[model samples]
Target: MGTRQTAIRRGTNLPRMGDFNESVVLDAIRRVPGGLSRVELAESTGLSAQTVSNICRRLLDHGLALETGKKSFGSGKPRTLLRVNAEARFAVGVHLDPAVITYVVLDLLGNVVAHLRVPTPPVADPEQTLSGLSESIRQLIEESGVPADRLLGLGIAAPGPVDVAAGLVVDPPELEGWGRVPLRDYLAEETGLPVVMDKDVIAAAIAERWAGAAAHSGNFLFFYLGTGSGMGLVVEDTVLRGVSGNAGEVGGLGAACTTRGMVDEAIHLGVLSHDFTPIGPRDAERSLAELCRLAAEGNATAGDIIDRQAVRVGRGVCAAATLVDAELIVFGGPIWPHVADRFLRIVPALVEKSPFVKSLHPTRVTSTEVGDDVGAVGAACLVLDRTLSAQPQSLLLA
Candidate 1:
């Protein structure tokens, strides 16, 4: 018989809740900023007082919830309130870019504890590169002074055309010697910790949902302009991972809009830069930093390159917005730090200029407030999202 085919999946983790009621209680308490009293929690979750007390006790014991000052609504006795202990646990997130490797340590409340950026080693030597990154991960854990045991796990966001089922990077165009490299398993084995892996843009989308620009956005598109360009689609509150794990690969769309007879492929960084603004020329400090400087200094050539790039990107966004009916478009990535203001100002109007898109209300386009840390932060949010965020599946199982 042939090997079974399980490549088709949404890339979501179904972590069986050890105690559904406890999770529900925790979710309810976390949603409130000032915390909620046991009575309020019980009323909101529809759990009995005794059950709420029991669950609260467990939550407090685990350091997942903290008891704050008492609150009294009426003439009744003051009741102790509970809140999520934002510092109780930590998670590590890594974003592997061809230009740089980004790392972030996040607390329970989605706050950054520690962050670092390091030069990326060529994937041509996968093992050595993995080992080096493993060392960086260890250093962050020790330096942050967070107990190793309290760490939830490591989450990684790598560039795409990846084989999500095998947790491998399969011939991702921008990177070299990364064919069928089992990144998830290798990192897990190297660090002796649980690891979760997803495409870089997908992870960014999850980060947006957690606490970034798209926090309350039910439907949106994250246009990632990194060493290359891609898009992340979140429709109806779920990140859409297509059959092969590469859903929003829209690099070709930019080239398609122009008439240069050029082939715009998915892996090439053509969509992200122009001849005047070459991204990472193997010698420059950064891909677009110098170009941005020139443009800021009134260089018409550099300014023109950025302008055309933005127009094409806006056209692509407008097309995607029309197709997905996206309410918002978040422009982000490592490169956005230098050109975010320009993208935000230019892209929205360009998108609105489209007759099709003009009919629909103008789509909101903005830079990632999280800035350069988005990819790594997004990576970390994946673990927190998978492990702690309340899911509708829990309701069904309960």
Candidate 2:
């Protein structure tokens, strides 16, 4: 589990304003696995030695940092090396997909300490669904044995389009009866912790950048294949959320790649019996799994249908990669594991052959190292990122 150092912002030595500078030093230390001495932290963060020492002292006193050991450079006395206390703080993330809801608890290091999955409640009452979701989160935290006092906050990864500023889940296509639900505020009230929300694809991309396959990649695209499908764009090490925080919608590309759409196609083509027609999101997933099974068992028509789908996905991703000049493309979501083998065989070659991708820079295509639970892990990372990671924007005066 490698972690990439985020965009660098120099620390200021100004008096009575060490919060931003402290975050800068902590961020620098967390990025290095072996740990850093106060001297090394000051050199890397461009903060004065005194400022670094003060920040380190605060961190140690708060139990957020630890003196791992001593490292000697040359003949001088050994300098104490500081490393992050990974268990000192934790975050909880919940991913609300159309067919399932995922819950995860992550430590400061973005490791999933506990997780649980439940089928999305079929009841049309949004209040009931929310109550169930809150209970699940409570149970997960209690079962994990994480102290409530040390919990940082909660993060939600819901289907878009979300009202980010207002903290609402606004009329997502698949989440029926959820019209402008105040999900963030509701969860925050129930859990008694600050909550942050983002689109599912965006959160998944962040998870990859934080602890998964794309850790080393500043420029990449994460294609999320789930009950629905979409893309998450990372450019120059920043997750791109447009003015409305809905940048990942892929238009018809998303529709064409949806599990329902594919299952319907199979039924229409007579490859699957009309009995397999999906009546709901979960049914659609079951049908898609059967279709994949058929293809794996050498059913020619089933194989053809899946292959054609792979082509559409490949073309869409290639076009997107070229547009973003992305050097890496990662695939993951709840549904990814089922189709990974087939998609990987087809997608990588398409990328390699894309004229724009080949001419400018080599693009690598692969599956997410965070496994199928990436959305949930990513949701947790949202809290970790906000609470622990140093953001240059935090320096801006309100």
Candidate 3:
């Protein structure tokens, strides 16, 4: 028998090289809202003048960048300025919470073109839930009227314990009956687009970095309060996803601050009647909302329940902020809107009083600027970040 020899082809670096350079140039233009000149792009990205010109030409031709106007600097020739064409590309984001699933279509500039919120089906069957989610996404995109070709991809912000590598949603505490569902791959196949997944808190943090409260701050902590609770840590402008892609799990802090925990506590303390006992994620939210109403109406017991939770949250965030040396702490999630007024009043003081936080640098405490739908917005940002944003990790070989 004759043995056939197989030739192994060596991989070339040219394929990713142009993409990386283009991303760098695009990122530079995006940073300057008013726009940047080709000279400025060359200077900022450390690319050659010809390379910048070539990239800018490609960007303009692709409708990703536009020549906004012209500017002259110190007797130099008038330089044409280029800015990102926000409408040129779009991304879909789905935030899968236990109580509700939020869907949003965002333009390249991170502006929401359209959005919808639907109560999550109460069924424990993952297939049924997945079908509903897929349909909702399709409806949203169709109703929004965005060109399918312009859509970069879909992103999902799910609860913690997500296996990001495998694109699976592990057994999240709040999302029952979803055991190791291949969310990313399923969505990618269903939507005919690339899909990315991250923890909801992490996604929220990325959202803030992209367009919300942390837009100006490189180091910050996003304290997310929803059906459950957790923190998203960004240090030195890099989001920290540990070895397992679950870096922000608060463990006990999350248990102590969950909406369900608060509702249960209210019931046990007689602040809320047994009839108010939560039967599901939405029930917990409703009960918590009622508790907030009672507290606002001068019910001391209800107020105390919320206040104590504030204290616990405050302590947890302060420790995290100090640990990561974050300069800003943003709080938001579905449940945050219900408790923002209360949390702001208490958490800020605790942060200001922390010796480490106060003595080193002022840690600004604020709510999310991305609104209550930050998770959804962040989900979209995952696509934007992956496709557009220039990161050092992209240079590493697979």
The numbered model that scores best in TM-score is 2
Clashing pairs for model 1 are: none
Q: Count the backbone clashes (under 3 Å) in each candidate.
A: 0, 0, 0
Give a tens-digit lDDT track for model 3, residues 117-215. Answer: 999888877898899889999999999999999999999999989999999999988777888999999888888889999999999999998878877
Task: Predict model 1's lDDT versus the native.
Answer: 0.75
Give the clash count for model 2: 0
Off by over 4 Å in 3: 1-17, 46-50, 72-78
Please give the lDDT score at residue 229 for candidate 3: 87
Quantify all predictions' global Cα lDDT against the true fold.
0.75, 0.87, 0.87
Q: Between candidates 1 and 2, name the one with more favorable TM-score.
A: 2
Instruction: List the candidates' TM-scores in order.
Output: 0.81, 0.92, 0.91
Clashing pairs in 2: none
How well is each residue in 241-303 modelled by candidate 1, as lDDT tens digits?
Answer: 899988878757654332121112211434324443323312232435666676678866666
Residue 398 miss distance in model 1 (angstroms): 12
